[model samples]
Target: MREGFITYKGRNIVFTDYHTHTNNSFDSKAIMMETCQKALENGVEQICFTEHFTLNPNIPTYGHMKWEKYREDIQTCQEAFKNQPLHILKGIELCEPHKYTEEYKQLFQKEHIDFILGSVHNIKDIGLRKTLAKYSRLEAYDLYFKEMLLLVEKADIDCLAHFDLIKRYSKEAFSQDDFEKFEPLIKKILSKAIERGIGIEINTSTVEALQEPMPSHYILTLYRELGGRILTIGSDSHYSEHIGRGIKEAYALAKECGFTEVSIFENRCATFVSI
Candidate 1:
């Protein structure tokens, strides 16, 4: 066994970096093979390339992904790593799936992916960063979770990505977490996620840049208290060097939050493995 590697009967992925992107994503240019090689170098056993995918005609991500090309690269990566420890999963990180239910419906009618991470990259059609300029940091965060609650309530998503993603765009104004201040709303959001059988991701993408938890310690504790067991850890890497970054730290944090296993998905079904 690989040192520090968690195994699931030597057949299932152990949940390494599930939120990942590559050239297929609108905002990233990392090559697929490079990401795989980098994950292998970092001792990552598996990675799901959840490239940014959206159908908003008003956004840059609309029609940006060449699905055919992306599938080819995944095939190539799987073949190249067929003899190695790395297992690449096909996934898509969707923006506001609840807002584009019909589009998502059409998508699922033809395509089936292993995972989908639902995120609110924008609020009311405005970018999170732009919202900070129009509202107080606290206001922006409240709006963020409120919009996120919509997805948790309606989207056919496996998990919610970055519960406090607004913090990523509002750090300039406030470097602290405000989970307590928004506890009621957050409780509704988390409870809805559990009720809908949706999971959440501990996005470690900001561990180096922001030095903060994605959901804060409070959010993790709340999920546990609510009996939420389905969670995954991801680096949310957009570049090669970002692959597998902060994964060990996220695993430790999960353990501290009273979680023994992290989840992985295949054909959209979750399988938990010891972290």
Candidate 2:
């Protein structure tokens, strides 16, 4: 698969990870500068620190982010690496933007974030971590996909992060048959993303830990078959050591699935880089 990488004037294509977390996020412990150095060493030309900033009232991490300090830290890294080849970008991974419309609108009004990743972390107000045991298997899958469709249609984001993340925590093991049942909703979500100019993130954090990335290989292929062109690869790393894990494989998989380019964002606009 690595042999299929398209070159630009004899230069190998480098990658940009638009989704990552830092110590500013309640769940991560990665120091900003250390992560930058690690990413640069791993051949990531551009890296965006998308710290978790959620508005969900039910979650403990809500309102816990220190936005000013987070932005300051990113600026420090950007300046520190100014002369280097690695480009540091500031971003936020907003959980469930469709559920927090007012907060989403108000934050974007003042925050000068370079990238915004819209993700659905819960189903019907119950977080995914605790949701599996509360509902029937069928009900859980239904609610999850339904919310994803709504997010794709209503959330104003540059890309959808971890489109099918519930599988990572579900009580039932996911199977190809299960994904086949979800094909219709999946297609709708992909179609809406394409129409809205939003890209899909291939979250590689799951690959090292869970044996596959979020949304599975079948879903990635289906996205390409459905004419969805925009894609991004993210390690979703909470630690510096995991900075570039599984990203090369994610890019190769995208190339195999017929995606010639991966999307990167700046000030909410997408720029495509060939894989």
Candidate 3:
């Protein structure tokens, strides 16, 4: 890591972890300002706080976010780091955006946002971790993909975060290498993403436990082969100490997946930056 810029094919790879949550989110206990400070110290230049935004009242994320506070917190971090190279992006991780059209539209009218991350953390009002356990690996993954496909097709989002998160609770019922059965659905999702100009987020939090990103390396390659251009990486950290845990490896993996540039967002528009 030369000057903290890892060399890959004569280029320095600088990373931005775009998937993060803090005290503003229901499941997180991290203070936003502290998380930003720690993440920057850990070699991450850009930290996007994509706090979970869910409409399902049964889930923890529902009715939990204090929009004004979350916004003010990011603004404060920006002012504090104004002279530094640190960049803070305000984003929301929308759970099932497809199902809340009116509410989703209203978010834009009332709040200023930089990015929207779509995700499927549950099925039939139940968290995937609990819902997935009730079925065989294939059956469980199939259900997850179906919901994910629906999200891709109908949701108002920039990209899908933690695309293959179903494996987090698989309990060894399926191996990461055995995703051949889900190729068709994966391809469809990738195609739709490319068509919609929505990028794919390679969530690296799993690398600490599963030794790879959420969607796996194979899915990443497939995404590149399908002419997908936009890509984003995240650590999915909820605590300050976990801020940059698997960030470097994620960029290395993206390079291996043939992406020389990655996408960053502001005001709902994307800008590409070199790896």
Return whichever of 1 and 2 wins on lDDT. Answer: 1
Worst 10 residues of 2 by lDDT: 1-10
Across 1-275, the per-residue lDDT of candidate 3 in tens digits comes to: 00112222222337788899899988899988889889778988887889998877877678988888987999999999877667888999998787886888887778888788999888887888887678777887888888888888887788898888988887774475557788998899899888877778889888867877877889999999999887888889988999877877887888998988887776777777787
| Cα RMSD of predicted structure 2 | 4.7
Top lDDT: which candidate number? 1
- For 1-275, candidate 1 gives per-residue lDDT tens digits of 00122234565554489999999998999999999999999989989999998887766678889899988999999999999998788999999888888778788768868889999998878898889889987888888888998888888888999988887776564444465888889999999988877889899977766776687767998998898988888888999998988888888899999998888877787878876
Off by over 4 Å in 1: 1-15, 171-177
lDDT of 2 by residue, 69-95 (tens): 997898899999988888788888888
Which is the leading candidate under TM-score?
A: 1
User: In model 2, which regions exceed 4 Å deviation?
Assistant: 1-13
Cα deviation of 37, candidate 3, in Å: 1.1
lDDT score of model 1?
Answer: 0.84
lDDT of each: 0.84, 0.81, 0.82
- TM match of model 3 to true structure: 0.92
- Model 2 residue 157 CA deviation (Å) reads 0.6
RMSD of each predicted structure: 4.3, 4.7, 5.4
TM-score of 2: 0.92
